[model samples]
Target: MSKILIIEDDLSIGEMMTMYLYEEGYEVKRAENGTQGEQIFQTFIPDVVVLDIMLPDIDGMKLCSIFRTGSTVPILMVSAKSEVTDRVRGLQTGADDYLCKPFSMREFAARIQALLRRSQSFPTPVHETPAGHPIRLDFEKRCLYVNNKVVETTFSEFEIMRLFWQNEGRVYSREELLNKVRGFDTYVTERAIDVHIANLRKKIEADPKDPKHIKTVWGVGYKFLPDPSLS
Candidate 1:
């Protein structure tokens, strides 16, 4: 009985999704524009958001970016724009999942369920790097802390860090990181992954030039090594 917010300008689509989600046993809220959507998001506090990209008041990308600044709620972006750039932009801006228009209802429902599952699974799991001075990831709050100071993170950045923190010593190629984080359906490039990793290093590492937590694996890929002593 999770709550859901549908922020879509199209009345027909919004009503239809509301009805469908109601039938699926979810408490649903609806808003037709970004301003109203933002208000409802703060008040209703939904578990997941079904956001349309082309809103009248504010665009979905802007709204998503705003939401990411405060909350870690899963944002599933929906749009008619099927271009790879559009998809990548949506993901880069902090949408947890992006779905092109004309998507099947079954897949839509499944994606919502998956996002909710991921969001609600961790109650109080705190992952820490194995060093004298460690980086801590608070799963419940979707927060990253270095030296006990909060470090702001985008949704995609948080996911990548979570993957690495969860599997401390495992190597992940650029392709694998893209597929695992942004999903296989999205057209995310290796460069995007590199950019995300670079940004993360800047936030957590004292020196981005020589990263300690996330290390390069020669030509293969990158791995997260917990113990700073191993660096």
Candidate 2:
């Protein structure tokens, strides 16, 4: 019963997407333009947004960027523009995935399924000790705990974090991560990487803005710099 929002200018296309998602058993909401889209987001709070770049008011890029300022809800940009730069721009603007227009319904369906799968995954964290304290990552328990509380993480996020946790101080490029993060290697626009990293930042770091653990490289990639003093 996941809720999804579709912000598209084309009525036919919007309805088409809505029909398909509905058939797939997802609750769908539609917005004709960016302005209306934002309003709907405030009220409905969708699990994901299928946003189009070109809109009547306040372009999708601007809207998505604004949405990222507060929520980490996954965004998938669907547009007719097939340019790599456009895709990169969408990702840079905080989109989690991108799909070119005229795409088949089957592929679109698969993408939604994949995104949902990744979004809902939560691993049993690795604990630091048998006492079940929430202050450490217990390798045996496979859970993360902070302040005697369990730290939630997705399956992929946990693996990426574990690598950094073990290494302590090391950088991993997007390419390296594509291989490490599984079949995600095929989708190399960096949107998925950015989103996953964004998710990790929210889950593990004390302050996602000034992250002390996961640091971003200006033109390269991301690194793990855990405080040596931490438990």
What is each predicted model's overall lDDT from 0 to 1? 0.83, 0.74
Give the per-residue lDDT digits (tens) of candidate 2, residues 36-105. Answer: 9999999999988899999988788999878876665768889989887788677667676788988888
The reply for model 2, stretches above 4 Å from the true place, is 124-176, 179-223, 228-231
Best of the candidates, TM-score: 1
lDDT of 2: 0.74
Clashes of each: 0, 13
Error of 2 at 160 (Å): 5.9
Q: Over the stretch 92-185, how does candidate 1's per-residue lDDT look in tens digits? A: 7877777888877777888788677655555567765456666888887789998988988866688888889888789899989877775544
How high is each candidate's TM-score?
A: 0.83, 0.67
Model 1 ranges with Cα > 4 A deviation: 128-131, 154-156, 174-199, 207-210, 218-220
